[model samples]
Target: MSDWKLFTDAACTEEFGGTLTTVHKTNFSDNPQDFVLYFANVAGDPGDNQVLELVEATQPGTNYLTMSIVDANVGSGHEADEITLATTAAGLDTAIAGASLDLGQDDDSIGVIRLLSGVSAAQEIHVRVENAVPNEGTSTELSSAMVEAISRTKSTA
Candidate 1:
């Protein structure tokens, strides 16, 4: 729908990341396999905001470098502004679709993104959005958004 920005605080204020908002984290713990993230859209047509991919920054592409997106949700709640999102994204028996998520809303988790296993070592993973055009030219990498320095201990059991 529109370009987005990143924020450290839950209120969505104090914008961090780059001008277009980049989510970069170094030394990411591997204990929590399920990682949570929020979403919001700006007022410009950037690209198709359909799916998200996890790849190593060193190997920037859909190569299954280090991480994986187990699952995702539209969002439980969102904010109209950079304030507290007092309202929930769903009401009654409405089904929330991740494909048609409201990018206009404030940062809110999609849902249940789990990782199979940690990387081989301390590696940087780049989380980027893509336009799923189904073998069409419409597909493209949406943003330079990324997360880096993810670390975890490989169990030797």
Candidate 2:
């Protein structure tokens, strides 16, 4: 049976803008798998126009999973939007702009993305939480960010 395995856990209270990448140790087989992210913003208020996105920070390029709002107080509301797993820079930018997650509130949200079939066994993978659109001087605090891996196992025919 396939099960979810804890890959990484991170928490921070500092205010940051732009992109933040956290590298974690993981053993991902070449088989199909999924990367699940559980994250929350406990304290502080992320501005109205702030957007949060969880991305796979690979060496050659980055893959975007979903986007959310950092502040619930924004007009957009708290909702996780799907982003196309495109490798191009313009495609990624457009995808991120279309989604938002409200992080100013106390509640948490999950974002899941499928790992590429060609993914090889690696010692570490980078997970990035980006605040693309921060409203002026406002900032948000990341209470916790957890990543879990779920792999599919094959059975002998």
What tens digits encode model 2's per-residue C-alpha lDDT throughout 32-150?
A: 11123323222211331112222233411122322333433444422122112222333344444324322112112222333322112111222223333323333333222323222
Q: Which lDDT tens digits does candidate 1 get at residues 1-157?
A: 1233343344333444432232323233221121123332222213333233222344333122221222222231211111111113322114222222211111125322212221111112212222221222221122222243222221122
Weakest 10 consecutive residues, lDDT, candidate 1? Answer: 78-87
TM-score of 2: 0.24
Off by over 4 Å in 1: 1-3, 16-30, 33-35, 41-157
The global C-alpha lDDT for each of the candidates, from Candidate 1 onward, is 0.25, 0.27
TM-score of each prediction: 0.18, 0.24
Model 2 gets an lDDT of 0.27
Ten contiguous residues with the weakest lDDT in model 2: 116-125
Report residue 13 deviation for candidate 1 (angstroms): 1.2
RMSD of each: 20.6, 17.9
Candidate 1 shows a clash count of: 5
How much is the lDDT of residue 126 in candidate 1? 19
